[model samples]
Structure formats: structure tokens, C-alpha cells
Target: MRWIWIDRILEFKPKQSARAVKCLSLAEDFFADHFPGWPVMPGALMLEGLAQTGGILVGEANDFKEKVILAKIPKAVFHREVLAGDEIVYDVELLHLRKEGATVAGKVLVGAALAVEAEIFFAHLDQSRSQQFFGDHNFVFTGELQRILGLVREAGKRPEQS
Candidate 1:
């Protein structure tokens, strides 16, 4: 199955930062196998949501010319459990950007409480390399991603360009 991590953008700033939300539902398949009776969202999945948000931010900052993949997650702290019916808000900030890679700091909050936080690093790879890396992963960059990229481009544009 395809993994759709991010739900929608709550707030966004071009080349700077973004906040997005992911609502976890009881009907999700992972809950059935994660623990059976006492199902809680996994730390790794929570981190994946944060990483997805950060990837989107970094890709936007680079104008989406290159495919960005999670290279490393240096630090991750899970402070609370996330159960079904919880909405996870991910706030990601671009720390640095280079030709080959970018670094971002991200946090996952369940309501007002912190659930998970991490510093993620991403590497920009060529299209062929990305395809090889994510082989048969069934990943799709949807229209929403395009719309977000357009917004980022517009926001990054100079007054004369706009």
C-alpha cells in the first residue's frame, strides 16, 4: 500500500518553514497489527510524518528540481503516545540547504502536547537515483504537492517578478 503521510498544510512560508497535519483514524490498518488490543501509533511512523513534512519543506526551498530523500534522522524524542482519533501537527523548519542536501528540524504535536521531535537530514538525488532508491514503493507526487510548490514559488518571487 502507498504511504500517504501528510494530510494538508496548516501554515507555510516559502524557503523557511511549514506546518501540516495528519489525522490518525482507528480504521488504519497498522493499528490492527501494531499491538492488537492496545494499539498506539508507532514512534517510527510518527517520525515518518515529521520527515514527510520536512521533505516537502526542503523540496519547496529547492524549487522541486531534485528528488529529496530522507538520508538520516539524527535525533528523535517521543514524549507521549498517539492513539486513534488524534491529529498530529508537524512543524518543520529549514536549517540549512546545500547543493547536495538539506537539514531540517521538526516536531510532532498531538493537540497542545508534544508527541515526537527530530532533526532530519535529506539528500537531493537525481530522478533516476530516486526511482532506484524508492523502487516499487508506489509513491506519487499528487496535485496537492504541485499546488504547494506553486505557492512556494510565488512566495519566493521578488516584487518585480510577481
Candidate 2:
């Protein structure tokens, strides 16, 4: 099963940045076993949320023709634990974009408190290169995510206006 950490795109700026939200619920399956009685979102999942937001922003800059993959995490820090019932807001900013890849800085906030932050690198893959490993499924999955995140219009007419 695939998991989409972000619940919605609160704001996005084509090549510059994106802001998204993820509302944690106790009903989520992972919460059952993640910590038994004391449930807190895993640090790794928080990182993935940041990566997803950054990846989508980078992919949009290229019109989604290239598959964006997280390449490296040069820096990461967690300020506090994220628990169920918390709403995490992710802010991803583009640091650099080049032919080979892109670099991004992202932060997660719970209310006014910082929860996690990281510097992420992304590699762009053309369909040819991406298909070799992901076949067509990855593209489909990404398209769905973009739609759910409101990065693309549901009618498929055009990219989000702003």
C-alpha cells in the first residue's frame, strides 16, 4: 500500500516553493503499532512528508515530464515529537535547480512550534530513465498525488493557476 503523507496543498509557487498540511489521526493504521499506547509520528515519515512536498514542487517546475526522486539529505533536525491529533504544516523552498537535479530546504511545523527541518536533493528522471525502474505505475501514482495535492486541476485543463 502507498501512503501520501500530505493531506493538501495550502499554497504553491511554481518553481519557488510549496506549503502543505498533514493532519494526523488516531485512526491511521500505523498509529496502532508505532508506539502502542504512546503514539507519535515516526521521524522518518515526517522526512518523507517534506520530501513529497519538495518533489512535487520540483516536478511542477519541469511540467511533470521528469520523475523527481529524492537523492540526498544533507541536513535534518527534529525539534519536537509529532503526536496524533496534531496538524503538521510543511514549508518547502527551492534552493537550486539544475539540469542534473535540484536542492530544497523544508520544515515541518506543529502549530507555532517547529517539528522537523531538512535539506533535500532531488534528481530529475525522464520517462525513459524512470520507466526502466518504475515502469508506468510511478508516473500514475505521481499524477494522482499532484491531483490530490491540488498541484494539477482535476479536469486536466491546466496546471494550478498559482
lDDT tens digits, residues 87-132, model 2? 9999999999987789999999998999998999988655235557
User: Clash number for model 1?
Assistant: 0
Superposed Cα RMSD, model 1: 6.3
Q: Give one digit per residue, the lDDT tens place, for model 1 in 1-162.
A: 457577777778877898988888888899998879877999998888787778777877766666777889999988989998899899999999888888999999988998888999988765445657666543334455656545545655637554
C-alpha displacement of 138 in model 1, angstroms? 13
Query: Candidate 2 — which pairs collide?
Result: none
Off by over 4 Å in 2: 127-141, 151-162
Backbone collision count in every prediction? 0, 0
Query: Which lDDT values do the candidates have, in the order given?
Result: 0.79, 0.84
- lDDT of model number 2: 0.84
- Model 2 clashing-pair count: 0
